[model samples]
Target: MASTKKTTAAKVQAPIDNRETFVSLQKSFADSDMPVEEKLKTLYQLQAADSEIDKIIQLRGELPAEVAALEEEIADLKERSAAISAVIDQLNRNIADAKLAIAEHESIIEKYQRQLETISNSREYDSLNKEIENQELLRQIGEKTINDTRMEISSKKSELEDLKDRLSIRTEDLAAKKTELENIVEETAKEEAVLRERREECAAKIDARTMSAYERIRASVHNRLAVVGIYNGDSCGGCFNTITPQRRVEIVSNKKLIICEHCGRIIINPDFAQ
Candidate 1:
């Protein structure tokens, strides 16, 4: 009758050690079906795969900035090239205008020379000669303007060519980097698939309540571990914190669910005495 009362109290608090429930929950996990060592192997494989996928995603995100920088540099180079081309085009137009002016001035000089040969008075002759000299001066100025424009056009073309070359090289480098990232993702696709499948299987087997507790604690902790094993002298394997004498006795008695006070982890006390 006393044992019956204790059992009734436990049932009122919560179902403790329902063998059927435990077996059902354990069966739910594909990992539980495997041997202890094999379960560890599967867990580790899943963890490693998750870690690799995270690293790959991080690496891919990092590459975008590098690629964007390169693209920006290339765009700047192209803008510079366009600006230089505009300058070159303006210079060429100026050169053409200067040549036209020079030709017109030369025609005026030739006409003045003909008129000077037939002038009747010295004053008129001197005026014609002065007009011819002005035309000659104008023609010389036009020639100098044409030469300067030609030099500017040549310099701009050279600078534009150099910018184009640099831009091409940078674009090629960006393409190569992008290709490398794509290849890495593609090569790891198989492993990623395996990890995802195993994670699904693990999720289905774990009880909702248990998973909720595990996730809550795992999210709060740095180690991401929610379960811990009790070792010698009732110490946690994870944190190595000693359990109190009373708690140890309670845990050994298997009266109810036990948690570590120091780490707040759900403890799985192995029946070491057996």
Candidate 2:
């Protein structure tokens, strides 16, 4: 007798990469039987998304520069403080050395006086007196050096205190600026992300030739507006140029792409303006 074995098939899933997804989207747009008005609508939607992104960027104007300026100021202040501290340290060392020199001079003068008491002749006593006089002069010089260094230390400490105060104020300012920038970024980040995705989807729906023309027109225009709808039922929204009846009829038909001669902006029917 022969036994039959049961067989099962494993299900395999195919992975889709980014390139495949992009090609699929491209094919859908190319082969779409959608009306011209729909395509123009998609293009206008892309422009609107891009404009919103631009507004978000504009809202953050000069904050980056201000933050950088604050950072630089803080660094300069720290460097100045360090330099002043080094000067103060050197001055303290100078004062210490002057005090040590004065002590040595006093010891030498005491030794000279002892020698004067033991001198056997007047000439030797006179020589001892001269030695003591020179040591006293050295002590006076050391005392003057100590006094000068102390005065310098006092002035530098005052300057250091002022710098510290300024640094504290600047640090507070920097913190406030950073917080403001962070808040702005946090507020706009998610909205910006969603708009970017919408812009990409809209861009994918537009044909390559139209997209290229749109980009060129947007770049050449002051407000980066490439597609504008009719305004006041007769004038171009972008340049305020009067749209002839024929042009208005052509634009409303959506049979072909039309651009304003004055501003080189693509014109759509007034109904499409949002």
State the lDDT of candidate 1 residue by residue for 164-272, as single tens digits: 8998899899898778767767876776677677766755554465455556655544444455556786697546778888877766564344556566554554553
Tens-digit lDDT track of model 2 for 1-274: 0011322113211112235543453354445566677987887788889989888887676687889999999999999999999999999999888899899999999998888878899998888898899999999999998888889999999999999999999999999999999999999999999999999999888877667767877766666677898988899887787999999999898766677766767788667664
238: Cα error in model 2, Å:
5.0
Residue 137 in candidate 2 has what lDDT? 97
TM-score of each: 0.62, 0.73
Local distance difference test, each candidate: 0.65, 0.80
Alpha-carbon runs more than 4 Å astray in model 2 = 1-32, 229-256, 268-274
Model 2: per-residue Cα lDDT at residue 113: 87
Q: Score residue 41 of candidate 1 by CA lDDT.
A: 34
User: Model 1: residues >4 Å from true position, as ranges?
Assistant: 1-47, 209-274
